[model samples]
Target: MAKGYIEFDYEFCKGCELCIQACPVNTLVLTTKMNKKGYRLVEDAEGKCTGCASCALVCPDAVITVYRQKKAS
Candidate 1:
């Protein structure tokens, strides 16, 4: 199995929840934190991101970056 995580460009996020909905692992959630633009933030609740890039692909603001651990040969 692959392991991965996501980083959010917090300031650019509009709290649209698109990334949350696009996440296949259901690890994404809304947080109490707010961006400079006053939009609520999303977080990887369980650290279970699969680096699928689904979230990033769906983000209208392009705020998400997914990073995966390289598999050992």
Candidate 2:
């Protein structure tokens, strides 16, 4: 299972690739498909996301929400 996952608000997102660049785990990428606004959507690539919030921090549109699983102690 992935350590974390991100949810994107495609309608609010501007399709900026800043989130993709900000992801330390390289979990995000810009897809060819467009959102309702006709902007290319950012999607999660196949990878392990560490839930660092880097993508959320860099997003100007505040479109990304991250969910992380708690590690077993």
Candidate 3:
């Protein structure tokens, strides 16, 4: 089956958690893992993303890039 994913620019992320709230699939979450600046970052909690880009849309820093995998027929 086709699946979706997101690539996050952790360095640019401000840990605002907006993306986590915007995600429709509830796949995104904030982790205890810190970035280079010691700020917690959002991560893909579930691998079931649908590439809706809702998380990307709400990100103030534009740190998310989404990709979709095509399923074989």
Candidate 4:
């Protein structure tokens, strides 16, 4: 089960593939399709991110946004 979700701003993403390479957990992947700007944007591997936010920190384009899971009530 997923603990959180990550959003990728394809508009701002330069498609440099830095996020893909920087992911320690191998959570990021480069899709075959390009973004609106015709750039290959980075995508998060579903159910893979540990909420470590490594991709968010290393993103040069600052397009990765990680939302962590909320605490139990």
Q: What C-alpha lDDT does candidate 2 achieve relative to the native structure?
A: 0.85
Tens digit per residue, CA lDDT, model 2, 1-73: 5488888888998887999898887878788989888999988877578778899999999998988888788
Q: After superposition, how far is residue 63 of candidate 2 from its true place, in Å?
A: 0.4
lDDT of 2 at 57: 93
Displacement of residue 16 (Cα, Å) in model 4 is 1.0
Candidate 1: give the clashing pairs: none
lDDT, candidate 1, 1-73, per-residue tens: 6999899999999999988888888999999999898999999989998899999999999999989999898
Better of 2 and 3 by TM-score: 2
Query: RMSD per prediction, one decimal?
Result: 0.7, 1.9, 1.8, 2.1
lDDT digits (tens) for residues 1-73 of candidate 3: 4578899998998899988888877888789998898889888987879888899889999999999887667
Worst ten-residue run, lDDT, model 3?
1-10
What C-alpha lDDT do the candidate models reach, one value each?
Answer: 0.92, 0.85, 0.87, 0.77
- How close is every model to the real structure, measured as TM-score? 0.96, 0.88, 0.87, 0.80
Pairs of residues at least 3 apart in sequence or in different chains that clash in candidate 3: none
In candidate 1, position 17 carries an lDDT of 96
Q: Which ten residues in a row have the lowest lDDT in candidate 4?
A: 41-50
